[model samples]
Target chain A: MTSILSGLESVKQALASQQFALSITQRNVANASNESYTREDAVFADVTASGGAAVSIQAYRDRFLDFSIGQEMQSLGKQQAQSSALSQIDSIFNENSGQGLQEAFSGFFNSFSSLSATPEDLTLRQQVLSKATALTSELHRLCAGMQRVQYSVNSSVPSTVDEINSITSKIAALNKQIPGETGSGNEFALRDERQKLLENLSSLIDTSYYETESGSITVTTGQGGLLVAGKDSYSLESSPLSGSGFQGVQLGGADITSTLRSGKLSGLIGARDQITGYLTSLDDLAATIAARVNQQHAAGSDLDGISGTDLFSYTTVSTGSNSGAARSISIAISDPRKVAAAGPSGGPGNNENANLLFAVKDEKLFTTSTETASQFYAHLIYRVGSDEQSAAEEITTQKSILAQLKNQRDGVSGVDMNEEAVNLIKYQKAYQAGARFATVLDTLSSDILNLIGA
Target chain B: MRVAQSETYRSFLGNLETLNERMNKLNSQVSSGKKLAQLKDSPASSAQLIGMRDQAAEIDQYQTNIDSGSYFLGMADSIFNEVNNLVTSIYAKGSQSASESVTADDRATIGTEIRSLRDQILALANSQVLGRYIFAGSRTSSAPFIVSGDTVSYQGDETANKISVDRGLEVQEGVPGSAAFNSIFSAVDSLLSNVSSNNMDGIQTALGQFASALSGLGIARGEIGANLGLLNNAKTNLGSQETSLKAQQSQVEDANMAEAVTGLSQVQTALQTAMTAGGSILQQRNLFDILG
Candidate 1:
């Protein structure tokens, strides 16, 4: 029952299949440079048990590699964010360039020592005032710098949330389109775009996602809060807290700021807390300076032979509150004569009180009486610097890991132009053989019809 | 690993970027000469540097104190030396007046000279240095002595002004007017009165007092000399401390220029190699190019 016409039909199907395979090879070569494009192969199969041929496009990709990349992207995002914020703090507290808090503190205390040398000298008294003024101004500048950094970090939350929402929206749209084009070669493009969007979302906030049985992906935050489910995307809200005026991230009316463990959002939140901690330490320094110096100064006599008042003053929220002390601290007395340089029992030449003030530099007064003001401030700087350094190290580690994962993914899914070229030659040769067979079948069928007519 | 065409170029570019970053870092280190441009570069060392700077500042302040103390003590030592000379002259005048062969006119002339010398001693006792009376104890704003007619009243206190020259070590900057010159003033008053009234017994007593006053001046000068010695020792010690502290700070902060420069050139060579390889590596003939 094998006829020339059916034989010709089988050759025709073979030729079409070869052409399809060649086109796929051409497509692979064309998209070799595209970062997101996964390589495709035309899979040929017999339509019948032994006769006709058919082809379908198969995309080369690994779901496990994509998942690993997403996780690494999250870690890299967190480290990069922390490193950047800490660098800003480090610059603000940089002492190597001089004119830092350490210098200001030394200047202030050293001025008191000089004042003690010439207790009655008006010029020396002025120097003490000037140094004190400079110290207060330095404290103010540092506090403001930290506050600005905190504010900037806090304000960025809304924009980051917006970015996450935008990415999730794109993912949901891709999720809708992926299942519709599942059997067709177009599904590869939809899946590639969705995977890219998922990686972008993971960097903004720690997230986990999985492809459903229907080929649609479901995305959730690290804490299992739904983001993109099937074809629907959820949005994150940013609202300010009551007392601090800092932005808090919320998902569907639930605060998720504290639950965020890794990603840019968490890193920014952690940075804000670190900055606040530094600010608190600075306030403690300012408050302790005001209280301790005022006590010693009040026990002494000024150049006018009157009991000294508080040398430094700051606004207080309550009786024992140290908050905002750095911002509010100021020299209480303006007159140079008001600087307490003499002891209570002695005349203008007495510098006992001035000596005591200078001695405050070494006192274990701040941080639960374990460190001097200078030591505490140095510790704060060390903490910031070390935190930044650790974050940078983490980023380096994460980046290398991410790079390796990306290369592994490339090995699985990336296009090879050389392989494509070889496929092109094989498919072209097959197509030519099928064409020659079709021409031979046509001649044989003509000869068979001529013999039957005779 | 099955490298894709894009992956090869991408990895090459990444390697080039890393090499370039290293070169830039080394360049900055060489140009700036500081290994720790930021605290984050080395936090522990940066903290140590801050502490060292603070200690240096403290040492500088202590040195200033030592200098001020030395100046005051040096002035006091010279004042006492002159006082000792005046006391010696007064004692000779008293001894001559006490001699029985001396004429009343001769005694009167000697008494006038002794009186002039006592007035000079009083002036020395009230000497002001840098607009503050040195011998006025804590009341240094005004003169310590008030002379009314033949007698001198001490207006200053008995307290000696102590200046801090070292930690827990305070040195008396100047001898109090009462301690250094009060007995001298009384001795000179006795000598003047005894010579003018021709009292030989009183003249002998005044000579004895003058000897004691000279010894008192010697004690005060001895204390001043001891303080000056302490100040000098502190200055030397602080100088060495400062030098050592600066050395430690440099160790923590300054970059090794030789190492940085060598590293820079090494990175440059790597970058050039990478670039050259990239040119050939990326242009690798695939089947498509060979076929064409």
Candidate 2:
């Protein structure tokens, strides 16, 4: 009777184990579409002394794939950010539309050529003033547009830091909970959630991380700024720079803006600097143009026979710095008669000075007198285009690499509906067999009872 | 390797996304007729396009200069011819008056004609075009020739107002009033006195002076003619240069419609095939469906 009861107990245990296996299959099927979910299996084992089955949950994942994907995500994030910023800048320098600084510049110079044709024509003098004003306005527009791009890019840094801090804090919480949930059936869920957070954090900032034996992760910035350690996470801060008022990143009160070499944050920083450099070049161009035109204009005489005054006026940021030259450039003289279209032997018809002013168009005025103003501006546009192109190309390459890695990872841990369906049937059949065995055991026990009836 | 359900879906979506991107690019190209919509599409080509545009603009300016230069020279050339004709008429009258058979009354009648011719020459010298004296050199706002007593004095300076007609080339727009009319005015003044006083030797000397003055006017007119020729040549050269630059610019920026349309259709067909394949694959029965 003890042996029959023991056989019944073993069958009951077998039924429970098979049901648990079916439940695991059900869980896999339910989460088949969840991108963050890892497939789980009920690993069955027999109880050595008790002669019954025991089960444990096993989650499928490749640690190496996770690490590789995280690294690739950082690159993808950086390229995407830079590409977006550069394309915005590319639109501002849209010379292809024929309504750019190039047109203004050529128009301004060509007006002088026209004035040289008929210096006595008051109408042509007015045309020169109008064209000069237009050129100055164009410079102002371009400079302002570039500054707006920089401001917008800089403004996003704080929100990005907030997002990174949020992710790190959640990861820290997961780190604390993962150890307690280890070896339990719920641990796999915590691990998968933690991995998703880590990937999210890595795309915002460049980070290196490793999982410890205790199932917790320690994350640090690429330049050794501690972000997450066990159950504690350090937060990043954004603050304005001293002179420029641009935002800079900080880690624990230390400026770490330069240390961030890759990721979205680093990409924004690089693009900001690139735009600032371009602004400086534009300022230099503007200042050089103003100075050269003013010099030539001063050497000539106007319609009233007075010596020429400055044709253009601009305010410099400081001594020897043309920081705001482009933004501040404006025509100094409003009177059309002030346009010096005459030589030192001044008359209403002398056009030697006007000819000289027109010659400025083809002069090598920038880049150590190697390129004309137009050429210099064209080069600036080319630089922006090339930068945007490279970033776009890098994004494509990085996306393919990430896709390949993700595919390999999905092969390792992603759910297979067919496999889950088959497991469902197999476990159901085993449970049915276990139930039938229990029925047979019951019949035997009853027969034994009848044989011993009084 | 085991293909997960999500993996097949992901790859199919990725392929569809790629095809859609190609289709979008081809559509933009076909619609805009410009292969380079943005500078980022091709930086080198964009830079070259800008350069070509600059060259084209420069050529346009040079052509305008040529036109303006031609007008100034053409006006001056015709005026010089008229002045030469007047001077020749006076010289013919002076030669006839210098002969011994001429009576005082005849000399006096010839004097009136010569004075009228001189007055006509003075009007021609002060000829204004568009409210500016054409012969005033750099002082074009006022008449360059001023009548003083019996002779005309040149008020205009010796500056030859030059306009740029080509790259590194300048052509004088007008000669100074002094160079064009000073000698002719002086010779005409002496011939008028000689005819009114009936002095044959003085009339003969004034006729010799008139011939030399006519030659001087001829030289000035010749300079203006040469300038017009230069401007015409520049205009022809610049026109052809502008055409070639525009052609190159078109090559750099304009899209090939045939290629773009062909690519658009090919991408459309590929996209249709991919969508159909994905649809069919997604609809295929799995193990769960078979069990149901």
Candidate 3:
């Protein structure tokens, strides 16, 4: 009782199924070169124990690998930020190039030493003044350089927060669209786009995401702070600090800067701390120089028979405050004759004070109480250099690890063009066979009808 | 695990980046010829270099002080010979007058000559070198002697002026005018009076003063010789110290040229190898040939 027309209907269903499968193979072949696009496969379901087909596209994803990549990205962001800032510090303190304060300090102290030879020589006295002025100017330049670095770090934080908000917004949009687009021919591409966005988001702020039961993804930032819950996204907020204050990221109206585990935000915070620490050390150097030099200068007499006058004064002159000492340091002596070159006897021929100033170069009078000014400054430079070197090494190391993780992800999801090409041919032949069978069944139905009519 | 096309490119780029970084550092070292181009290159060495440089500067200053001190001391030593000669001539004139074989006219003529010689000694004692009175102690701006008919007043303080020649060693800058010529002036006064009076006893008495004055001057010269010796020794010590410190600083700072050049070529080779590998891989058409 099975007619030729019903047989033709079964052949037509087979042709439609083959056509759908061919289209999927063609899509895979077309998108094999796309890095963000994952390889897709058709899922077929049976109906009533017969060869009835229902196909859906499946995009590949491994939750654990994505989490690992996110964590690694955060570490990479921090290392990169720290490396760049430290390199700037290294260049600022490069001694052999004569870009740093070492030469300036040596010139200043050496001028003092030379002043001893002919304490009455106007040229030598002028040399001392000129060198002192140059040293103070160099100190100012150094302080400004530190400020510029800190400014770069502080300014970057707000932009990073903005980046986080933008990424979260995109993730929310993708989440809303993902469920609606599933089984609508755009599901695989949507998921691919979402994954790419997540990678970017992870670089900006450490994050973890999970698939919901509704087939949507929810993104959370550092310490499980909500970023995107299904279709809803939370924005990262920022506010200007009071008086040279840097804006920090806020989540749910609470500041999350200190809690940021690792990311661009964390790297920037670490950079700010480094800048502050270095600034403090620089200030200590400047303060100590001013205080020690002033103590000796004030106790001695100049060529003009005047005593009790400071040669270098910054802030309180005697007390070396930690902040702004370098910027504040200036030559306090007005007349060149006011440069003290006399001892306790205070005779014009006495070059005892000049000798004392020269001796200051070798004095272990720093806070560390074991290093001179020159030694301390050199120590500062070496500390910053080593930090930069470590940062550079870390970046190379982290990049390698990130690359390996990415390879693992690629193994699971990357498309093979050669395999897709072969699949393209096989699907095309099946479609052709199904179409040829449908035509044969139509021919058979027509022949039976024609015979009955005769 | 399968390497994605992006991962391959990233790996190539990272390797190239590392090679380029090494190349840049090696280039800096080679061109600058400094292992310590920056303070951060090696902090301890940089700090030590600074200390070494400071020591070198200190040594140079010591040398300057020593040279300056030696110049004045040498001036004093040469002038002391003139004083000794004048003192010897006065002693000869005093002994000749005390012999009693001499007439009054002869004694008078000798007294006038002795007075003239005494005036010359005072002039020599007040000698100014380099625009400052050499024997005037710390009050170097003026002459140290004021002559009045029979007596010479000593205006210069007897303080031993000193110039620092070493970190802890200070050498006498110049002989004090009072110490050098005050007794000589008294001796000359005694010889002139005895020769004028034609008294053999007084002339013999003045001869003792001349001998003592001469001996005192010899001792002052001896001190000058000691200081000059000290300055020379200090100069030698400072020179050697400066050389040693400079060597230390160079060790901390200057790069080994051979090592830097070798490193540069090695890094360059690595760079070239990485680039060639990356380029070859990029040019590969595995999928294209298979599909075609």
Candidate 4:
């Protein structure tokens, strides 16, 4: 009952449909390696209940999967950021190679030991001075390194905020384009593009997307800031107080502290604060060591027959919530020779010089505590060592926790090369079969056309 | 549970693929022996480890301090013993000069010998241990005693030289020139004057002063000996304390290698089984063929 001419038209339509399917398969093969690319499938429908068919492409992406991945990524991102900051601090305080404050402390102690043996030896006196100098230098270096790490964190926070704003603007723009382009039900390309945007946005900041009936996506920050609502885009801007160092971010003059918790901005902010706290502790250690050592050294008698002059000079800077307070330390030898030669009498008969030496040696001149200089120094070394050891141990524990979290996150969203290879082979075979079916349809149409001519 | 041929099934497969990739990464992490494989893994822990490592490095310094203290103490003891011998020599010279058979010239010679002995005492008092005047106490920059015209005086204070042997215990190891040698010099000065004048009455008085000087030296020697004993005791206690602290610290912080290794092996086995089982299930279902 059907005309041969109509059969040819059906066959031509079938060929066109098969070509579209082939193109879609090729697109999948190309994007199998792309992290953001969702594999697309052909949507086929029988043509008006006749023996013909038409095909449309459908992207095989789950909205729920994307949403869940984004949430997990956000958590992983924050952990990574915090971990980075802590590791940097660790490198700054590298203690294993004997290149830290501990070594300097040991050197100082050794100098005192040598002095005890040849107390009147000029060479030993010089060694003590040298060792003292080295110890103070080590303290200064450590304090400076900690401060530098804090400064780096402070500077990085604002830059990350700027990146978040740029990503938000991009998402809002995509939100506008997707709804208009997909209105006629040909939204495969638009959806693909939007998915790519979401993936990109996730890396810069934690994001979630909402799909409306019109196929438009509404994007929001992990912290719940409206990134894209219909056709409009909301931007985030940070107004950091000078010297407060990028403490918080603002979106449209409203504070969004909770919203920024899982993004790169949050990570940077946390890192800055944590590093600053660590630097403060290091400064405290340096100040305490310098002050205590100088106090003991100053109280004790020196070879030059003078007392009270400091042995080490430490740089003073105001710290804590109380504002400006002057603190300084100086540890310097008052005299570098024998007390007898240092005095006017210039011999061992000088009782005044002898008395000074006796007082220091006996620790009777120490007005503060009954403890001697050597005892105090020993305690200081032990205290500092213990503090550093405890911190390192804590760091190790935190690292294990971080590792577990990362593994959990990776379990949900990592790419597998073997899976991609299998997908490529499968899609390739399907494309070939679709192409052969189109050829057979063409041959049938040709036979029908010849019959019509006869 | 049916073979997933629909787009939803394909999407699920994609998720499973991603999950497999993550598992591989986790496997590598486990094998690497470090929980934090990168700087970003755990920053706080890394920083803390650095601090602890620095502390471990400093333990050697405390040991060095103990060794140095021991060396100083040894030198101080030797100098004190020599001063004791010098005191004996001066007493012998004074006694010989006090004999009735001795002439003025002989007395003069004895006086010269006494002055020489005084110089020797000064040398001992001004003895430098390491680079410091051991007798000068904390005033290590100069000699504690100065001698001029046969009169020896202490340049340093009467305070004995003390070093910290342990917590709350400081041991004075060096006798000050003012306390030990200066008084002896004064006693010898009086004895020399009596010998030169041939005054038997003065000689008798000077002999009493010399004996008193010897007694003072004996007391100083006794105090130093006592302090040496205290130092030895403190050193022993510190050694034990350090050993106990090290054990406690290890318990608190160090990983138990045997336990860790066992745990690691268990996790590895579990991971391997999961991978093999998951692989077999996927293959038996032939999900890829069904989807194609």
In terms of DockQ, the best-performing candidate is: 2
lDDT (10s digit) by residue, model 3, range A346-448: 5555567877886787688775699888878877776776777677778878888988887787777766655566666676786788688778877887898
Residue B183 of model 3 has an lDDT of 88
Error of 4 at B194 (Å): 4.2
Candidate 3 — which pairs collide?
none
DockQ of each: 0.69, 0.74, 0.39, 0.12
List clashing residue pairs in candidate 2: none
- lDDT value for candidate 4? 0.57
Which is better, 2 or 3, measured by TM-score? 2
lDDT of 2 by residue, B1-292 (tens): 5778788888898899889988998899999999997888998888777677777777888888888888777877888888888888888888888878888888888888888888889999998887788888888888888887668988877777788767798878867878868999999989887788787888888888876798899888888888888888888888888888888888999989999999999999999999999999988778999896
- Candidate 1 residue A224 C-alpha distance from true site, Å: 0.5
Residue A83 in model 3: lDDT: 79
Candidate 4 chain A: 10-residue stretch with minimal lDDT:
A321-330
- Report the lDDT tens digits of candidate 2 across residue range A217-256: 9999999889999999999999998877889999999999
Segments in model 1 whose C-alpha atoms lie over 4 Å from true places? A47-53, A449-454
Which residues of candidate 4, in runs, are more than 4 Å off? A1-30, A43-57, A105-136, A143-162, A183-186, A238-240, A245-248, A253-259, A288-454, B1-156, B178-213, B234-292
Q: What C-alpha lDDT, on a 0 to 100 scale, does residue B284 get in candidate 3?
A: 70
Q: What are the chain B TM-scores of all models?
A: 0.93, 0.95, 0.94, 0.76
Cα lDDT listed for each candidate: 0.86, 0.88, 0.76, 0.57
Q: Compared with the real two-chain complex, what DockQ does model 3 have?
A: 0.39
Best of the candidates, TM-score: 2
User: Listing candidates in order, what is each one's chain A TM-score?
Assistant: 0.96, 0.97, 0.92, 0.69
The candidate maximizing lDDT is 2
Clashing pairs in 1: none
TM-score of chain B of 4: 0.76
